[model samples]
Target: MTSSGTHTVDAVVVGAGHNGLVAANLLADAGWEVVVLEATGAPGGAVRSAEVTAPGYLSDLYSSFYPLGYASPVLRGLDLARYGLSWRHAPDVLAHLMPDGQAAVINRDPEVTAASLEAFAPGDGDRWLHAYADWQQVAEPMMTAITTPFPPVRGGLSLLRRLRTAGALRLARRLVVPVRKLGDELFDGAGGPTLLAGCALHTDLAPEEAGSGVYGWLLAMLGQQIGWPVPVGGAQQITDALVARLTARGGRISYHARVDRVLTARGRAMGARTVDGSLWRARRAVLADVPAPALYLDLVGAAVLPPRLVEDLAHFRWDGSTLKVDWALSAPVPWTNRAVATAGTVHLGADLDGLTGYAAALARSELPRDPFLLVGQMTTADPEHSPPGTESLWAYTHLPFRRDWRADEIAEHVTRMEQVLEDAAPGFRQLVVGRHVAGPADLERENPSLVGGALGGGTAAAYQQLFLRPIPGLGRADTPVDRLYLASASAHPGGGVHGAPGANAARAALARDRALTGAAYARLISTANRALYP
Candidate 1:
């Protein structure tokens, strides 16, 4: 272990999830001595996998599907296979079970997928090919920007270069349009809208939001290109690989260390004061991989925060809360529409109108009469995830962020969800041998950072993105304090297990060190203040 007093290194990273671990590994690789602090005994806040319900069954603590994982440049660059991480994709990407006896199955093979789509609506399948080609052109560079870090100048420029080579004018127009508009423009049919809406729902944004259309298009296309996969074991493999890489690069991890407050000396953030009364001072910088409110209100403290920052924090908006359900099934789900049985992911909604109504109800803080569901058949996706002959499944739905969900309401909702599956897959209820439910309150209990049980760290709406994320003025990882940076999903290029925020924070801290030597740390405080206020 590196001696703390004699050789204080470059950065101190809080949290050991994929993002924090990735940042720590990157800094260590760059020859900086990195130290990671985690609040929980285990790493990977949302990416954890454990045998919670049954002794042998490994359940994903939060996120399970990983189409994005394969597409991530940082993960690919790290080559996580060096650290015992491997991934497997489902034979088919998804199965959308309609209220009617019809279903759609999507696969990686364009021919097969197009065939499936063609079966639904003739030329719509060919339309998919055209859309996919356009998607491929934008995906690589767009992903690079979203996952690169705050401001994403390099990634943005790279995307611009690609667009210019392909069709700059067309791409530019697509960038500003809402996803719903894009879908309508391309495919003027129910199938296209239904498919695109499912993709857009993955983020916390509505399809009508400007920047959200890109996410919807990118995710759906990525699923087509690389089937939505899970790590052979679980989501933990991704986090473990990151931790292994960081440790291999000489980074240290301290668990059960909750940061009480960020400490500053002469207006420069020096380190953090842990809840246990121990202070761990950073020689270079402090990276906060927790949420924005936690970074600003809990750690940074109002005494240090400028007035504008306090006001900005007051107006931040969180997305709808979510309800997650995990089921242990004795028999395979019997979909009335047999095609749904073959799907790894199943989206449930009556129709486009039903989905829109669901979203509207959520916005108004009312439980929907007809809910839209995102379901994952875990055992189907990766057989090893559960005990033999038994299926494991995970499903979730968005609810009004703060609407009260009584025990009875939760039970009713779960029953309805099962009925939804039963409508498509009769006898779905009978297949369930065991069940565990995680409501919005439960999510908040698990990770306070997911305040109000909002995933994607507050809404991804146009009003809350990019320069306006978390707060209006300061969205670039740097906070209103010196050497302190927000490295969570709450920062720019928001959420979804991407390490952009942490990477951006580390880069800014490194940049500060380069600009003014030891004095650079002090400049961070002033600059952060200006950014937060301006």
Candidate 2:
């Protein structure tokens, strides 16, 4: 029999994604009676691994390659390894295929990577090395500030300290400059711009967008430093590990329990009402890991939101459109270039024009004649992801976020993507044994948090980042109302499998639930930083 009671918990987490899991784990560790409510029948939201097409062949449903995953200090604190989590990297970092049979391969060894750039342009190798060296001066602290739950003052102080030691003025310009401009100014070879642009395309934004080049450089350099790695098993392994950890600590998760509305009492979130009209009360607070709009508009009534916050939410921009295709291949993708065979990730495009054209097409709400594809050859990175001699491949491309293409049109988009690959590798399509496709609508159906099918919750544009995320003045996880916090990609510092939002929300919740355990709790946070940062 289902247990029904007015059971009150110390805190309630509204979603069971990675961020929510992080917040739940931290709070549970802090001795809070935490209960996690998940919309799906499982945890991990976008970070899930499943057998969508065939049995024994697992696919990372959303997030496959994780450069940020390894860089996330928040996840490190969880000691996921003890709960059965590990990582594996690709042999070659990545490969950028050009139109004229020319390719630039980023090797794990920075020297080899620089040499490849040198082959394309004589002095570019030296320039690339210099850029990386300069990046090293601030990369550590910069990552700290960006990911940590620092307020404007603390955040600024962190940035200033990093910049002070490493040329402030130049770093300032780099932060403001559009990615396209940065690429043009830094790299002087035919390979340079395309390589930089391909990396920028990882997000839904165009390379011409301001502040986007940083992501490209950060990710590319990160791949060089630590190759793009996947979990030893599949993405689900990460989720399962988190679940294992939570259960070990006497915490529990309720899957297929979609919380329809957040229960409120006297203007503050009290608990959540499930889709079945049942309510679960929380003694302290409720943390929501769903998208900001979904949380504010759907779960909580719009009237409850502050006017300014509502206005700001109206302006939040979801990233460009995405169409995902997962393939069950009989054999590995045969590339004419051959080097890409060993590479885990491939950025497929003819040249800069081709990429820019792809973006332009999206801007006009139309699919490009030849879409630039970000393909993840999963089996190449984790061979155990599929059966022997077979490969699992997934590719996604951005389109106009609102484009409503029909089935035939989507087929054409897939055709164009295949054409781009086939141009480099003849007979590329023949290797496909089974295939599955998901457009914006399908993505939303799979995970409601991907509202409008937004992968990163919302676009990572400058206007939407930091103080302006979700809405202005709500940056520190806490909303206008006390004890009601947002712990999702929609919160500060934006998305990825990094558990910063979750950790941030937990800290805020703990601080609010004080007085009773003030001194005891104070001692714990002092050491929490060491665990998180170390």
Candidate 3:
């Protein structure tokens, strides 16, 4: 019999973000009773949308484009389209504007995309196609390797078998090549390298950073393969689809229920106790879809962790924050470069030099005088995002991490950003009918996971990726804490709307449950460690 304010479920998932909901859905499908708790009144976490500026204009409060969202196997497997989640692909994927009033665009057609590069350099058209062909040879197996748990026995071996000896070595070298170097090696023109550099800037990595090339290549290929698509009704449609599926499967979710502490007994997690003093017991596992720092330091407390692990947590670095501006425009942006008018996503900050400067300034903990902007023209992707003729647009720039953020300072930065846009599109400011600004503080206030608005969950630096993610260990979804798992953006395949972390975490938990009993338990635990992959 359960006591008042106490309930028992096979699993308790803390947080209702995409990953958390995915974990809950999988667990419930496996016949485990699952309950999810969210701190906010709504379920999506940062994947939310609202008419913050005006009644008819829909704005994605945080994340907008879904190149990864459209490609996520976990999401695709769930068949979200049947749940009313329709994606709107842009006319062209992305465009990197050049200083001379021209732009490099990424088209879905391989021939067309390469042709844009060919116009700039003599043989670049062929080179771009050749490079994409090389990527296609390894893309599927490589993506499988990335999305699966570390030491991906199946996926990794498959990739290796495909790459063989020479190809394997070349693949390794390519992973660590800087964006600038990759550009310099591939094409002689500014357009190709500049486009890659802009994608690299999507993360906190500088142009010169090793492994920055991977981000550029990954996004570029993904954009080319599946255009940067967004949900028709805004990002919230994604959350609604996941929730619709989860609840349909008998999983439960309680919003505004913050888990204050992980309940432990006999050195294993039992469940969690909420701030409202509700005790929810988990018969199977407790999966936390929050940041590593929040899980270890805040919820679990430092006393429970090994001193060395706790010390390592102290050194864990986060990526730069964001300063975002959303607008309900009276008319579409009038671009100096007419090519940019039709682009779904437009990048500003010119070329490699400008991007490098923006990155360097952030690294030095100083605000950039000329910040790089990632602009999402919502109406370009989905006309329903705004009223008929008017447009809905958003631009975001990265900022250094900070403990101090003032409103006045935020406004000043906003003004500077508008100025930057004005240079690219002379009448940009005049088109703004309604505007909403979310600096680091505003971002944190909306979603705690955004910790300084580091959107990728944490730094995506090479040292922080793969097995070293969140913290150094085997990159399984399982944590050192028994019966508990870290199944969020902080986990493997760090950040993005992909549900790999959740699926992987649930798989790890289920595998552990099926382990041998008594005498053979030790051996099963060893198998369970590597068997965490899907």
Candidate 4:
């Protein structure tokens, strides 16, 4: 089905990542003739699985858990279960292991999570429940606002309505407060604070950073509401479901077709040309599921982009690089605390102070002597991830981007990462029957979009968020070039397994193609772009 020569379609979706696939599905669903061009031989992009460590062991290459995927309305609406997408969860959602052998755990049951916190300190259990209650008041509007496009007309209005009843000022204050402060203000024990801080670390944000509270609170609340679930077989199942859904709807995907340039005419994106000289023409739009820099500078070229956009791209910041180590274990991780064994995900850092120190080191562009590790117990979450009685384990830690990551350096760092685990789980190294290490360079090589191994598209920092994502503009999927939409993690609402970026782009394309209002919508978007980028 990989057509070579010239072909015309309603839309040409560049990159068959989840976002591109999502965009293709939405467009195809609307009766558009959409074609997806993927550079890789297969789809899935970062959300993939493989037996890198050993046979019969499946490790999620990049992202593993999908609390966001479960919560995403876009993914949920697709009803992927019909396409063989089954979700699996661990006995407990997550555990934050401390050096002293005590752990803080979050379970789907509030009482269980609260009781776990209460064990560390009195009154924290009730406080956790209170926090969840507050979240419920605005959860609908908040999620809508986050998942929707910026300016979020409907979602913003709904949130405004909820604010009146949900303590407007207090809620607004909480949204911007640092996670460290929020944790201290809400709970008396380190358990609650540590748990929140651990969640915050899921992003590039440190606990002390402003707006970190929102990320932490959002993720913690989602974890409480919906456990961090993984696909039954592997991460590939999610992609397979998306692909299956797309193809079933008569969408076509051309693999090994790396889009070399977005073909533009005057000021409009008309199609895409692959590196191998194959041109896929688009009658309606060309949605790029690549990174912002890649989309603007490399694919479209700066000559055609607005001068301000080119300038803005220069100052764009990327999140920290990553070092991931996967292991095919002979047995489960022998944690010092038995409770940690039941959790699917584990956050390893000594304490709040240790986490702060680790973040500070990353901020300073230095490798931490004690890195904060986000470890996934794949087999604990889903049995299909590995052989019977054995564990498929992987842990990734962020590192400062470096020009060179030598083989010996990666090996040494692997040893250090294992040592950190050894401290919390005695004999953890002994269970490793085989292991695979992927540094920042290795990751970017596997997926070009993962620049410098920095995931989350770009930094999740406040400065680069909302209307400021990728670059300050309208924050819609629309690019300076007409009929082109940026439908990748680089768009608003940023990263995670959520398909909001792609969904938003699809909506924008559809809105611009409407019979009566299409012209007006296109004019309004183009006019706004001119006003901002001029």
Give the winner by TM-score. Answer: 4
Writing each residue's lDDT as its tens digit, candidate 1 over 1-534 gives: 212222245687887767788778778878888888787788887888877666566678788888777888877877889999888877788876666656666788987777776776768788888999988877777788777655677877877787774586777677667777877877745566567767788776666667657776777788898888888888888888888888888889888777788888766788877677767778878898888888888888887777888887888887788888888888777766767776778888755566667777777778887778898888888888788887788788887877356878878888777777667666788887778888877877776666667878878887888878878854677676777777888888787866677677777777767754647655655666675586
Q: Please, what is the TM-score per model? A: 0.93, 0.93, 0.96, 0.98
lDDT of each: 0.77, 0.80, 0.85, 0.91
Q: Which candidate wins on lDDT?
A: 4
lDDT of 4: 0.91
Tell me the lDDT of model 2 at 302: 79
Off by over 4 Å in 2: 1-5, 150-159, 403-405, 516-534
Clashing pairs in 3: none
For candidate 2, lDDT tens digit of each residue in 248-277? Answer: 887878777788888886766798888766
State the lDDT at 477 in candidate 2: 83
Tens digit of per-residue lDDT, candidate 3, span 165-228: 8998998898999999998998888888998889988888998999999889888988888888
Over all chains combined, what TM-score does candidate 1 have? 0.93
Residue pairs of candidate 4 with colliding backbone atoms: none
The number of clashing residue pairs in each candidate reads: 1, 1, 0, 0
Q: What value does the lDDT take at residue 380 in candidate 1?
A: 84
lDDT score of model 2? 0.80
Q: To one decimal, what is the Cα RMSD in angstroms of model 3 from the true structure? A: 3.0
